[model samples]
Target: MALTWIRTHDWDAGTWRNRSACRDTDPELFFPIGATGTALDQISAAKSICAQCTVTRECLEFALATNQEAGVWGATTEEERRKLRKSWLADEQAAAG
Candidate 1:
């Protein structure tokens, strides 16, 4: 099958995005419900879907690289990503010192 391409500001056709399991799923699965608090059921559902995705790590890395502030990516909630960003920044600062 010819690979379906999606618009991304990051990597080009050379990346693994073509193989993403979330490619065919609803786009909203990666974002929060409208104006509603992030419910555990919703997060669990998204994470469960991500758990089986082959490109989960790539997706997470993309979110981190792009500083995505909202939505679920690669089985992680927004808060999780926030903590990861903090940790990554700390590691970078430590390495630079």
Candidate 2:
């Protein structure tokens, strides 16, 4: 049996994107049903679902390995992961500098 890649969706394009891609995401996807409070709330709801998902670990691994810039996944917030990524990039830059 072949493994099926799961996507940690963050937005509309992602929600509707082809499932062929192993890992994919978008940070701007939001639910506009009714009077939505804010993007933050939408992200929070999505994160809650992600937390209970079966493929969360794999999703998180993929997001981190790919150095995803934004989107909610892997028990991490966008700002949190971005800071870590920036530092990693800085280290790499310094090593090459």
Candidate 3:
């Protein structure tokens, strides 16, 4: 499936954020400063929260749609999202063709 829903769906039209597992958690947990040591722990912790989230798909879609360049969203780190974004854009282009 595509990582983005922005093309056919309104990114801001849903209240899925209200149901996010990280809503009450520290926002900084998702935006670690580095990719190793403490940052890896933080990323793991954040992804754990995302793993239990019911809105994970929506969260990922929103992140991809908005080009979120930092933090963990939908159990994925920045690097993971970048790769997924590339594939998603490719899928979008292929579908358009």
Best candidate, TM-score-wise? 3
Ranking under TM-score, best-scoring first?
3, 1, 2
Off by over 4 Å in 2: 1-37, 83-97
Q: Whole-model lDDT, candidate 2?
A: 0.51
Error of 1 at 27 (Å): 1.1
* Cα TM-score per model: 0.70, 0.46, 0.86
lDDT of 3 by residue, 31-95 (tens): 99999999999999999999899988888878887899999988888899998998877776886
Which candidate, 1 or 2, has the higher TM-score?
Answer: 1
C-alpha lDDT of residue 25 in model 1? 80
lDDT tens digits, residue span 1-97, model 2: 1223333333223432233222343444423233336766766766766665655555554555577656665545666566655554555456557
User: For candidate 1, lDDT tens digit of each residue in 11-59?
Assistant: 3335577787777887776776643565666677778888888877667
Task: Name the candidate, 2 or 3, with the larger lDDT value.
Answer: 3
Clashing pairs in 1: none
Predicted structure 1: lDDT: 0.68
